[model samples]
Target: MVALRGRVWDSGVMQNGALSELFGRMADVMEILAEDRFRVNTYRKVARIIADTPVDIGELLESGRLAEVPGIGKSSLAKIEQFVHTGRIEAHEALLRRIPAGLLELLRIPSMGPKSVKAVYEALGVTGMADLKAALESGAVAELPGFGRKKTDQLLKGIAFLEKATGRIRLDQAAEAAQIVGAFLAEIGQVKAIVPAGSLRRRCETIGDVDILVTVDEADVPRDEGRRTMDERRGAAGMGTGRMPVLRAGETLATHKGRTPSAQEAVIEAFTAAPFVDEVLASGPTKGSARIRTVEALVQVDVRVVAAGSFGAACQYFTGSKAHNVALRELAVKAGLKLNEYGLFDGEKPVAAAEEADIYKALGLDYIDPRLREDRGEIEAARNHTLPAPVSLKDIRGDLHMHTTASDGEDAIEEMAQAARRLGYRFICITDHSQSSAIANGLSARRLARQVKAIRTLNEKSRDLTILAGVELDILADGRLDFDDAVLADLDYVTASIHSGMAGDREKLTTRMLKAMDSRYVNCISHPTGRLINERGAMDLDMEQVVRHAARTHTALEVNANPWRLDLKDTHCRMAVEAGAMLAIGTDAHSAAGLTLMAYGVDTAARGWATKKDLLNGMTVRQLQVFVNKKR
Candidate 1:
């Protein structure tokens, strides 16, 4: 109901993530209490179901259909209802009263499960990590059932590894992971749809976790159907097209159908045991949870499957910004209708249950793009029918910031250019690193001069492709440009960036970037905040001021599409657009094979709610040059 577009409101994807954690905690507490295995299994099943669900549990309960959902029953439903209404579960509180809350920390260690912990607590009086460590050191836990010296050593190592993964991962990391897992599940004969949900779907810059939703054909039950494959359409539509193996439509799955097996169970079994998965946290027919080992870190992944009738409802519910869904739920309430993952209903009479578009239509708002579901004003825009039609991967005319063997790039300039041409690009800029980045084989002034000459030399012979001389100029800690203006004047594009000093003072960092942007030689700022997904934190710079200055100076802010650094973050891109600044989407590629990665940045820009009008690369070759010149 807000009038301003993209209005800011503190929000989240509350229920699925929050409840999942709660249930996981409950499971731990039950195990610590050393309760019967059956009671613990019951809560674990509920957690799995809640984690996989697309909609809020409260919504399902409020609609009086909580018990009808698969895996939900009278006992579990009562606990969920009690927890939702009272903010505390009596059983959980009672357990907490008996056990030291600190003991719960033991479960987070990969090697420590409830039974293992229960045995230790009863044998050694160990209740927390500190006690557990002391017991391990004193040979106190070695003789406990299922506890061995080797296992103790592994737990010690696992504890240290767990501590390192405490913060957020770069959104691209989560997206890439989902892409890998989603692509893998797409070939499962029983899985009808595979869609990523949660913060990854909302396209947040940093992701806390990942969730993927699927529609399973219960009757087929994963029979290795020859028809289910990653056709060209799926390859293009799904994630990591270039990175993972695609399952062709006609390929055989090595296994045949089991006798009357449940489709959901079959898919979950395949997913939990996928080669990319490191560990299975929870597994059931309806939902699966696992840890995926990426080159960066072990990331948590969740998969939820819904029946076909509730597929659209599940998609919308799971792909949520808690604030956005809450807004929609409020809207539905005003219209005298109830909305849940099952579908929209008016007093139990079905309204829209099939397509997401129809659900939005039934709610009287034009379909709001998932990227705009941050409650930043998309709802009001949808009401006004003025929602932005964001720039798509197809709208890109060129990739402007890339490298070549002239610097650290794996491919030569000519090879990168040829790859761009094959992608039907009108222009490509050779933005190899300049003098300061020695590790990247940075180019010296003389080397840059030679590279520029070669680029112009190649452009003359090319018919469909236009090559632009560019430099990824380094900005020092003291706010000085690596290449002189004399060098920049001759180049078609210059991307100024901070390679080091990311951990310096915030005000100083902002000033340093502002100084770089003030230079007429700078066309864009690459990976404005030099964050490596999950590995490091963002630099302490004032992005609002930097974006405003870019708007004023006509310098473009780059969305570096390295999958590791989708910098400028979608929010910053939105801020840039709000300040009338233009954006450039670049793969910041170091090789020819990196061209396909532009889709990641395009996806990020769309999340920022940017359109073709907001992008500099959307311009034709001649037009791009004019824009460059105009900035100059």
Candidate 2:
């Protein structure tokens, strides 16, 4: 099947989440109908497993590994298989056939479950949310034996809370919220380390909620050990002094084989009452949940406190794309050890947990970066010690695509060069727009030539930077370059791109890009797919064919660093690398300020699993010149 840019892969994740919901519904229905308790519990447990798993169930079944997966037995397997093949599970269908679908939805209400749902349904015929609200208003639900006025009022509050929390936010929005919350908590001296977890940590495109893991150093909390009374000492050699002056109230959530009140508890308490927090779902010493309201959205943030010793284990556990962690746990099992958030255990002895690398090392695997923790063959790669050490933001030597005042860019060429030099870059390409890009103040052949001479003069004056004369040539609808070859040939680098004709016919689009890639004057293709995230959807092209053609030619592909246009995304980066094609990460900077966006491109490249070996910007100026000069 032809893979779609925003389809199957993302849809698979959603499918898994939906299955979790569906399975839980099945369990709730069976329980209410008074089905077998064992089967009900089995379904409930499996729902959690399915929900946590990163890979799609259908994909697992296709691989014939469904049977071997934990929490999936013959009965559950049949249900899943039936759902995959026929689009519906008979067991689920049977249960739905018996109960009003509305009652199952009622279980979604805060603190409401099978017993309460059954009671409400029987007493007031309140089968759905609307019915339940009506019953409450009529005083019918309040009259139920176990549910008093307070419970009814709370349920109303829960309904409103659930409604607000129902829809998910985009990954970018969640990221902003997490950063704000993290910065706020970092002020507290007790917080040793704080990092994002859940889908946000995994860098999933869309996030259900943001989970943050906080490690509290014991030294940060106050301890009162000096002169405990005899009776007080007798109560316990006791936990460490959990002196937290940060919050109004703090309590221990949980503790492992360590001593002292968990430092994690204080963090939980402070986080719950943090100024940004809008609601606290669950709060304890080890883990805290709250909704942090950013200017644009309310994002749920989970803070898990960990001791110093188990820091690595807990980080790995909570930073999970569950599918990735499940793979790691299986590896631990095979090695005759158990891995959990607390630490990896060899029977009664603790093995590795102090550091994330140590935990992976103990498993005989290389440390897998959190971004690559999607169980997409990363485990096998790690086992063989072949995991790609992706190119970091620091490794970038220069940018290849940028514009200046000659185009519609805000900065002058000299100013842009100064900005790049300040970034310690060895070189930069002034890729101003060509004649066809009138909207961007496209430079004519005369203007471009003047710009080139000015750059050459700047190069002579500059001690630390080399400026390359370049043009971002637009490929016309008919596969013709904006400027003739004579003009392109004069430039040090020629980067072709699609600004118009983005929605052209598929085959024509692929051909148009291929024709540009085939040009001797073109050193690279910019933002190969022409996607403007959250604005313009990616264009249609046979990416496989395009990537193959790029490899055949020596032309590199540009991973546009602009957050708005992170084209040649993580998958394409990997595709280019595996095909032995070089890649360039360019900020596509229009102004000096846009140069900082290089990190965003690097992040996208990391997600694609691209390493220095796969990128052109990782090269020194001389080395990069050799590759850029190839098409000529």
The candidate maximizing lDDT is 1
Candidate 1 colliding pairs, count? 6
Predicted structure 1: lDDT? 0.77
Report the C-alpha lDDT of model 1 over 1-632, residue by residue, as the tens digit: 11112221112223444455566677877777767888788888787677545456788899998788887888778878765543335566566678876576677676687778778788888878888888888787877767788998877766655467657787656765675576567656666666778888777767887988877665654443412332332344332312112222453343323233356655666677565676888876578888985424468999887888877888899889899999999999999999998999999898988788889999989998888899999999998999999888789999989888888876788888778877789999999999999988899999999988998899899999899999999999899999888989999999999997777988999999999988988989999988765444589888889999998988999999876778878888889888999999999887676776787799789889899989988998777778778867
The total number of steric clashes, by the backbone 3 Å criterion, in model 2 comes to: 5
C-alpha TM-score for every candidate: 0.67, 0.66
lDDT of 2: 0.76
lDDT of 2 by residue, 1-632 (tens): 11232111112122454455568878888888888999899998888667545456778888999889888999888877765543345567678789986887687575688989988877778779889987887788888899989999878866765555537665556766676566555545466676677877766555787887766656644632211221232233222333222222532333322343345554565566554566888866577788875433467888777777887888789888889889889989999999999889999799988888899888888889888998878999998888888778788889998888788887788877878877788999999999999988999999999998998898888878889999999999999999888887788888899989787889999999999988888889999998755434688999888888999999889998876577888888878888877789999987775676687688778888888878888888888778867767
Residue 428 shift from truth in candidate 1, angstroms: 0.6
| Candidate 2 wrongly placed segments (more than 4 Å) | 1-172, 203-206, 223-263, 278-281
- Pairing residues by index, what is the TM-score of model 1? 0.67
